[model samples]
Target: MKIGLYFGTFNPVHVGHVILANHMLHHTALDEIWMVVTPHNPHKKKHTLLDNHHRLEMVYKATEEYDHIHPSDIEFKLTQPNYTINTLVHLSEKFPQHEFAIMMGEDNLRSFHKWKNYEMILQDYDVFVYPRIAENQEEVILKSHPKVHLIQAPIVDISSTLIRKSIQDKKSVQHLLAPKVWSYIDLMNFYQ
Candidate 1:
């Protein structure tokens, strides 16, 4: 089985995320996509993040109906300041039966070289990149790394930051997230 690993903080799972996962499943050769909910992303600001447990619950709520899209808390058991290379290495050892590929946005590809043992990651695993509107610089970077493949998933302009701000401002996030996820956020008072 070939699996695509889509890692994110998912402060609150949104529609854009669901759409992207669906797009990847339908368009790519991947059999399933595991939405790996990271506890802390080294590249992101910690102050803006929700608790990992809460974030994981939201992802679970959002993806519960879809068998192909799974919410994973695999990074929670791993060390903090989670790095992709270490996670990939651990996953490879534990799930040797499945072929794993890294799913990421073009924006992340631009900074791929800065990641820990990035060259080893590129050589050992396939990276699937979805285009981001603001990160056109990824093209230049991908030119240097032949292992990276550009995927034409629908670009989602929505981001977790925007959703958090909306909740903080007491604005409606009706369509931004799944109904269950929105209810969970409301129940927990997340981002408020």
Candidate 2:
């Protein structure tokens, strides 16, 4: 089985995430997409992040109904300040039968060289990159490495940071997230 590992903090799983996952499944050769819920992304700020378990639960709740989409808590038990190379190595060793690939945005491609063991990642695994609204499409395509492939997905501007800010301001996030996920956030008082 070929799986696309879409790793993220997912402070709150929103509709944009679902859309991208769906788009990838529909367009790519990937059999399934695991939404790898990272406890702590080394590059992101920890202060604004919700609890790891809460973020994982939100991803689980949001993806439960979709057979092709799965929420993974693989990073929770791993070392803190999660590194992509380490996570990929662990997953590959654990699931030797399944071929794993990295799923990310074109914006991330610009900074791919900065990641730990980046050259090893480029050589060992396939990276499927989807377009981001703010990134230059031509620049990303021109800069792509041998392992990288560009995918055209619907560009939804919604982000977890924006969603968190909306919640903090007591603003409506009705259209930002899925109905069930939004309900869960309200019921759990997440971000409040």
Candidate 3:
């Protein structure tokens, strides 16, 4: 099986994420796109993030209807400051039959070099990159990388930060999130 790992904090799963994952499954050679819910991102502030369990639950709620795209909690059991290379190595060993590739936005490609064991990641696994609203770093980094694939996807101008702000302001976010996920968030009084 070929899987595209779309790793993120998914602070709260939104429509943009769902659309991108769907696009990857249909447009790419991937059999499935796993929304890997990172428990903690070393680069991000922990105070602003929702609990790992809540974020993972929201991911599951948001992606439950899409059979081709599933939510993963693989990072929950791993140590803090989880690195992509470490996760990839572990996934490869546990699921040797599956071919895994990293799925990310072009914006992330801009800072790819700053990641731990970045060279090893590029050498060992394929990177499937989708475009962002104003992304310009892809060409710079992928100019000579054979394993990096640039995928053209619609750029949705939405972010978890915006969603959280909307919720705090008591604004409607019906179009931003899945119905179930939105209901769950409201029921649990998250990001309020």
Highest lDDT scorer: 3
For 19-138, candidate 1 gives per-residue lDDT tens digits of: 999898888888999999988888778887888888888888998899899998899999898789898999999999998898988888877878899889998998888988873543
Q: Give the candidates in order of TM-score, highest first.
A: 3, 1, 2
For model 3, give the 10-residue run with minimal summed lDDT: 135-144
The lDDT of model 2 is 0.87
**Which lDDT value does model 1 have at 42?**
84
Query: Which candidate wins on TM-score?
Result: 3
Report clash pairs, candidate 1: none
Q: How many backbone clashes does every candidate have?
A: 0, 0, 0
lDDT score for residue 98 of model 2: 95
Clashing residue pairs, backbone N/CA/C < 3 A, model 3: none
Clashing residue pairs for model 2: none
lDDT of each: 0.87, 0.87, 0.90
Q: lDDT tens digits, residues 1-192, model 3?
A: 999999999989899999999999999999999999998899889998999889989989998888888888888878888899999999999899999999998888878888899899999999999988764534556535888899888887889999999999999997899999899899999989
Q: Write the per-residue lDDT of candidate 2 for residues 41-156, one digit (tens) a residue.
A: 77787887888888888898889999999999998989898799999999999999999998998788877878899889988998998888764554553355778888888877
> Model 3 Cα RMSD, Å?
1.4
Give the TM-score (vs. native) of candidate 1: 0.94
Off by over 4 Å in 3: 135-139
Q: Is candidate 2 or candidate 3 better by TM-score?
A: 3
